[model samples]
Target: MAVAIAVTRERREGETRCAVTPETVKKLIALGATVSVEAGTGLGSSIPDDDYAAAGATVRPDLATVLAGADVLLKVRGPTAAEISALKPGAVVAAMLDAYREKAGVEALKAAGATAFAMEFVPRITRAQVMDVLSSQANLAGYRAVIEAAYAYGKGFPMMMTAAGTVAPAKVFVMGVGVAGLQAIATARRLGAVVTATDVRPATKEQVESLGAKFLAVEDEEFRNAQTAGGYAKPMSAEYQAKQAVLTGEHIRKQDIVITTALIPGRAAPVLVSAEQAASMKPGSVIVDLAVEAGGNVEGSKANEVVTTAGGVQIVGWTNLPGRIAADASALYARNLVAFLGLMIKDGALAVDLDEEILKAAVVTHGGAVVHEGVKG
Candidate 1:
């Protein structure tokens, strides 16, 4: 029998992206999966029901009808409590479940007896790259951060040599040269800004320099070995952080725009920009904090709101930057879901192998219990 897969509209506020696009729906159908989509699921992404219907998915107006008896459920965000209760026992769900923070949602999935996989938990291995939602989304977030900063800044990014006079180019400083920071640097540079970036991970120096951006760091022994084997930034010592802060504080004061994208998995975002740092920035300067939702990398950043400090530094902390560019974000995110779903379907039937490394890492609940080590009590 063909595996039954259902896609529903995301219920999260300000989430405009959908889990499945018509293009992915066609691919799922070709893989022998019976795809059902709730009516208007793709509306926010500008994908109408007609497109999904044309792509071989049954578009039902009622979400319950779409999910009823479904063998697998796909979502952009974690399902709500009522959505979890609607799923059949033994059914599979895959989404950006945020298992690390949404403890109640994980418990609800366990109680509902649904086998759930958190896309954010997918390992950062070569084989799992196609299924890595975090990278795909963060890549866009980085690009969007630069764009947001440019919009918020009163001056032009590129220097202008007008007949009146010469205008200097914007100076962009990116903190935490991870995927997002790298992209922000590239985007700002492409817009003709003078970009400089720093990260705890010493390995990123080459990447930053390669993008024609100046690499700034304290460059101590601790910085030499500040990355995990998985290439994640390891938390630096207090002394190292203090030294780095001094350098960043000086750098921040000179920058016209700053974009901070540092995030520690399962932990609050590290504070790279303090109130003093913001106070030192020039008036009309802008700061975009991609880590705002995770407690903010900039001191005055508020999630989903742009605030101007008393000194006139605008802090852009709008959450879900990927959703701002919904069409492309939805396309990439849906493809990620399709690739991940491929792992669990065999011979046109839902066949989850919990022993698989990707599944083992991502599966937060299975067999009526929270099974992921990080989430289990």
Candidate 2:
């Protein structure tokens, strides 16, 4: 018999993106997998039950039945403890699985004897590019961040030389130059904003300049070698951080819009913007904090809230930036999940090899044990 793959509806408040799409349903079926999705699973992404049925997936209403019979279960967010408890002992569950923060859920998966894969742990390697959920989702989040900033700013992004009076172009400053940060810079530039970006990694300076934006950073000796081989930023010395802060602080006051996208797993997000800096910004200026859910990069920024300072500056801290573009995010995320599942599906059945490098990195719980090194205590 063919393996059963199920996609569940997200229960988290404010989570609109789904783990499956009609297009991916066909792809899953082509691999000889029997695909089943919850009745209202794709509604948030504007995909109805009829569409999933048309694509050959069984749309069931009972989530418990769908989960219990699933050989492979897919989800947008991590499965809660209650979710894992509903599945069979040997069921394979795949999702973002926020292992760093959801320690109890990881333990629950182990206790339930379910093999679980955390998409967030998908390795950033050449072979795993198709399975890289972070890149696909972050790309959309970055684009939306610039759009959100533009919406909040009172003035135009591009300069307009009118017969009455010339409108000056908005100045956009983006902190952090990761996947999200790069796309944010590109989107801001596309809107004709004079964009400037900063990052601890020296390699991104050229990338920022290529996007028609200036790169702002204190290029000290430590700055030159700030990135590790794994493409993560290394911590800088206290003196270097202070010097860089002073330099960036002066530049920030002139910015009309600022978007910060710095996040590190298992740690509080680094504070990039101070309250004083926000206060110093001119009235009508906007700040979008992409790392707000991980503890805000901007001071006084609240998750999923637009806070207006006494000076009239606005801080946007939306937790689900990619979900704002629901359709596109769902499509890309579904494709990523399909690609990951493709590796384990063989001869019209489930076949998992824990020795595989990508699987080794992404699989958090397998054979009733916490397998991933980072997540396992």
Candidate 3:
């Protein structure tokens, strides 16, 4: 018999992405695995049930029906403890397990004898790039951030030379130069904005310039060493932060739009835009906080809410920007999950090998214990 791969509807609020799409359903079936999807799972992504059935998926009416004794469970978010406890012994679960903050969920998976892998924990190495959930999703979030900011702005992105007068292009400043930051620069530039981006890591300077955006920052010694061995930005010293703040704050006053994407895993997002700095911007300017869900990088930013400063600068704290573009986000994310499952499936059966570096980094629970390095005892 073929291995059963069951994809679940996301129960987490504001999650519109699904683990599998019709395109991926066909791929999984071609691999000799039986694919089942929960009813209404793809509706948020604008994929109807008829589409999944046409693509060779069994559409179960309810969660229990779809998940019953499945060899594999795929999800956009981690399953609750109740859902994990219902799985068969040693079942394979892949999702954004968020193991660092959801330590209790890791313990539940261990108790249920389920091998759970957090897609977000996948290594940044070349071989696992296709399976990188963060990159796949952050790319969409970055693009959407610009669109959102443009909508909230008082004027257009591109400068216009009209018969009567000239309308100058909006000034966009993006903080943080990860996958999201790079895409944001590209998008903003394409929209004809004068884009300027800054990051503590010196390497992002070329990346920003490559996208036709100017890089702004103090290239001091601390800025050069601000990147970790894992390729993530290291926490800056207070003295360094103070120096960068003065430079950025003054620049913020002149920017028509600002987007901040800095986030530290398992920690509160560092405040990149202070309250006073936000209030100092031009009255009609706008700011988008992509890290709003992680306690926000901009002061006065609220999750899923838009806050306007007393000076009339709008602060957009819309969480899950990827979900705002659900269809494409789901497609790309589903492809990412398919790429990851390809490594574990062998001869039409479940054959997970934890020794693989990518799997070793992502597996949060196995053999009745919390196993990932990110999880402390």
Candidate 4:
């Protein structure tokens, strides 16, 4: 029997991206899986129902119909309680579960006798690179952050020499040189800005400079070894953080635009911009905090809101930056999910191999229990 894979519309507020697309639907069908998608699931991403039908997917109108007899459920975000209640017993669910924060959702899935896999928990191994949802989404987020900043900024990014006078290029400072930070640097440079960036990982300095952006960091022994083998940034000691803060504080006042992207897994985002630093910035300067959902890297940032500090610095704390560019984000995210699907679907059936490192690391709830080590108590 062929595995029944159903993709649902995202129910979370402000989530415009979908888990499946026409391109992925075709691929999933090629893998000998029967693919179904809820009607309007791709509307947000500008993918019409006709496109999915054309790609050999059944587009059901109601959630109940979509969930009916589904062997595997695909979603962009974790399922809500009501949605989970609609699932069949022993069904498999996959998405960016945010399992660390959504404990209640994890419990619900366990109680519903469903197997859940978190895309965000996919291991950062060479073989699992194609399934890396975080990198794919964050890459788009970085580019979108710069686009948002440029829209909010009063001056042009590139220097303009008009007949009247010469307008200096905007200065852009990006904190955290992860996937998003790297893309932000490249985008800002393309727009003719003078870009500089900081990250705890010493390996990022070369990446930043390679994009024609200046690297800023407190160069110390600890800074030289601040990255994990998994390519994640390690938390710095308090002493190092204090020194870095002081340097960043002084440097921020001169920047016309600042973007903060630092985030630690299962922890609050590190504060990179103090209130005083924000106050010191010139009026009309903009700061986009990509870590706002994790308690904001900029002091004045608030998730989903644009706030202007007393010093007149605009703090953009919009969550889900990639959602702002829904079409491309959906395309990349769907491809990532399809690649991961290939690991479990074989001979038109769910052949879950628990021994696979990627599957072992990503599976959060299986056999009516929490399975992932990090999610388990």
Candidate 5:
């Protein structure tokens, strides 16, 4: 029997990126999979229905009819309640499920008897680089974070010397030196801002300094080794966090712009900035929290909303930063999906190699069961 893959039309709120593109549709068809797309699914990303049709896909206006016989489902986010109920038992789903963080959504998929793979859970390793959607998406989020902050800042970024007088460069302090933070630092510096960044992980100092930005050091024994084996920032001890918070609070008071990007996988973002810390900022300071979706690093942050602190500082907490650049974001995401797709299917056939490391780490639900240890737990 020929396998059929369907692309979901509905996207999560503020999600402009689609899971797959017509180009990828043609590739899947060449691999012997028939492709069905919901009408207008790719509209936000600037891809029209004619594009999918030209690539040999069937475009159905009704989402239910398109998904009725789908053996595989590709999506930017997890299936919603109505969508899950529409799925056939034993359907295979591949998407950025955000599974560990989305407990209710995972339960729905299980009830619907869908075999699921979460792209976010793909192990961070050289072999899995092509499937690393988090990196691809975070790179965009980081880039957009700087642009958004600069827009809301109400001042120039680069230092300038005019006929009137010399203008000092804006100072940008970035929290969390992961992919998003690093990119924020780079982007801010390109705009001529003096960037200073910090992270719990000691290794990030070099990365911060390598980008021609200063590294804010909260030197202490605990911070010297505050990293997991997977290169993720580890939560610090209470005593260490207290000392670092005091030092960071002092630093926050003097910056023109602050971008916080710290996030721990499967955990809520640590509260890095207290309300007192926010009040300490100058009246016109700006803070952009990239972790607003998973709680927030900044005390006053609210997802997709901006608030003005008592001191008149702007707190930007828009969660889906990458969604603003849907065209490029979707292109990179489709490449990531294709890479993961190659791992599960080869030569136009489904090959479920359960023991394979990549498959083992990413397959959240299979055979009517939650197979991943983390998800199952």
Candidate 6:
């Protein structure tokens, strides 16, 4: 008999992305797993019930039933407390568990006796790239951040010269040129914005300049090499950080729109922009913090809220920006989940080898305990 896999839609407020798509559902069916999905769950992503049916997935009306029978529960976000209670003991759940801050969700998974794998915790290894939810979702988030800033800014993005007047191009400053920051630079440049970006990593300078954006380099002997081999930003020394503060502070005051995307995995977002820097921006300038969910990179940033600073600059800290483009985000996220599950299912049965490198790295809670080294006590 084939293992039963349930791909339920997330019920968390403001979460619109779905973990499984009809295409992935069809693949799971081919691998000898019975696929079940909640009704209307894929609607936000423009995936209809008929699509799932056509892909060999049964659409259940109630979430409780869908979860109760699931041998494996695939989701975008971790299951809510109530939903967790209905899971079959030892059922495997793969999703963005938000293990760092959402303690309640973590506790719920332990109590419900389900093994949880956090897609966000996937190690930055070549073998895990296809299964990386953070990279897949952050790519979309970075692209959307530029679009959001463009929409919010009143002036034109590209330079405009006409018989009447010549309007200078908008200046955009992006902090933390990770996946999101790089995309923002590419998008802003395509939109004709004069882009400048800063990162602690010396390696990112080439990437930023390749996109035609000026890489804001700070003259500091302290930050000769400031990147982890895993492609993550390493915390800078206090001396280097102080120097960067003064330098970037000057650059920021002149930017028309700034987007900050610096975040440390499993930690609170580093405060890149002090309140003083935020207050110095010219009136009507905009700042979008992609790390708003983890305490923000800018001062006074509230998750999911747009607030005007004392200097009249607007700080937008809306979390889950990728969900705003739900259809495509879901499609990509579903593909990521499919790639991960592909490793877990072989020969028409569930084969969870704890020894496997990818599985070992991503599995946060197994056998009803927080087992991942990063998340474990």
lDDT of 3 by residue, 166-218 (tens): 99999999999999999999999999999999999888999999999999998
TM-score of each: 0.99, 0.98, 0.98, 0.99, 0.97, 0.97
Candidate 3's C-alpha lDDT? 0.92
lDDT of each residue in 1-377, candidate 2, tens digit only? 99999888898899999999999999999998999888899889999999999999998887887776789989999876667778988899899988988888888998899899999988899989999999999999999999999998888999889899999889999999999999999998889899999999999999999999999999988999999887878877888889988998999999999999988776788888999999999999999999999999999999999999999999999999999999999999999999999889998989998888998888988888998888766
Identify the superior model by TM-score, candidate 4 or candidate 6.
4
Cα shift from native, residue 282, model 1 (Å): 0.6
The model with the greater lDDT, 3 or 6, is: 3
Residue pairs that clash (backbone atoms under 3 angstroms), model 5: none
Which lDDT tens digits does candidate 1 get at residues 108-128? 999989999999999999999
Candidate 3 ranges beyond 4 A from true positions: none
* Least well predicted 10-residue stretch by lDDT in candidate 1: 342-351
Model 1 spans with C-alpha error above 4 angstroms: none
**Whose TM-score is higher: candidate 2's or candidate 6's?**
2
Error of 2 at 341 (Å): 0.5
Model 6 misplacement above 4 A: none
Q: Kindly report which residue stretches of model 4 are placed more than 4 angstroms away from their true locations once superposed.
A: none
Predictions: Cα RMSD each:
0.8, 1.0, 1.1, 0.8, 1.3, 1.2
Error of 5 at 54 (Å): 1.7
RMSD to the native, candidate 5? 1.3
Best lDDT among the predictions, by candidate number:
4
The global C-alpha lDDT for each of the candidates, from Candidate 1 onward, is 0.92, 0.91, 0.92, 0.94, 0.88, 0.88
What lDDT would candidate 2 get against the real structure? 0.91
- For 56-120, candidate 4 gives per-residue lDDT tens digits of 99999989999999999999999988779999999999999999989999999999999899999
Model 5 TM-score relative to the real fold = 0.97
